[model samples]
Target: MATRSNQCDFIGAGGIIRDHNGDWLSGLSMNLGVGQVINDEAKRMLSGLKLASNLNTRKLEGESNLAIVAKLLIEVCPISHPLDNIINSCRHLINGFDEVQIRHIFRECNCIADALAKGSLSRDYGIVSVVETVSFDAPPPHAASAFTDDLCDLARAGSVRTRP
Candidate 1:
């Protein structure tokens, strides 16, 4: 999930479902028209989290680039932050899995999802304040062929691995 800092604030969230062997199964990308960067980031997390939860796959490992969001998901209580509502929603999604693990990765390793998100930002704003969801068989326009290799490298990278 990511936020596009432009004249019109945009939030982009993306998820790629893969098999146990790490083969890609499907992908989803959502673009939301919201100006707040934090809110957009939270929304992106929530959207991706919900998508994974709905898959009915019991054991799952989720990754995010935002440490704050991962921390909030682990400590669901406190609720002191302004984004408590969004954080709580993420907590609810985490409950769906029999065993769920969340970790934070470097921004560089999150290229595929980031590209999908940026693509959402560049898309035509139909309603100005609408959320658009797109499922792709191939990389979106914003993502290039090189991103595929980066995605593969990210899957194999062992740095900054966490179970937060």
Candidate 2:
């Protein structure tokens, strides 16, 4: 998730769904009008989790640049916060999976999603498909590079923190 201003309001949210083999499945980008960054981050995470579940993903791993959002999703963040309702809903979605992992990633490593979010900022308040290639050949010129970058990131060697 990203914000258009220094106050961290007016969010731009985006996420990508990929297979274990690093093949792209689907992706989403949305412009979430005006809200706090953390709130928008949580909302985007819930949407991403729902998308994964819809794709029948059982053992899922998700990463976000916002450590607070990651913490909230895993119940490490304070429970009495204002986003408790949304956080609880996220927990429910997580429980639906056989195994789920949500990790905090550095902003530099989350470039593809960031680019997608920026691309979505100019659109309406809904999903914008940045990349949805289903073929074995190759994606379009603009998306091929982003796809490659995300594939490398997915294949990168890093230990993920377990859910709380």
Top-scoring candidate (lDDT): 2
Tens digit per residue, CA lDDT, model 1, 1-164: 67574666656666565545554545667767666656766776677666655655667777677777667777655758888898888878778777777777666667667667767766665585667777765555566443456555633321111121
Candidate 2 Cα errors over 4 Å, as ranges: 3-9, 76-79, 126-143, 152-164
Alpha-carbon TM-score of each model against the true structure: 0.78, 0.76
Please tell me which predicted candidate would have the highest TM-score against the true structure. 1
Instruction: Give the clash total for candidate 2.
Output: 0
- Superposed Cα deviation of residue 141, candidate 2 (Å): 6.5
The regions of model 1 sitting more than 4 angstroms off are 5-9, 125-128, 141-147, 151-164
Clash tally for model 1: 0
> Given candidate 2, what's the lDDT at residue 68?
85
lDDT of 2 by residue, 1-164 (tens): 55464454456766667677766666666777666778777777777787777777888888877898888787654668998988888888899988988888777666556656656566555445332212222333434566676656653311121222
List per-prediction Cα lDDT, in the order shown. Answer: 0.63, 0.65
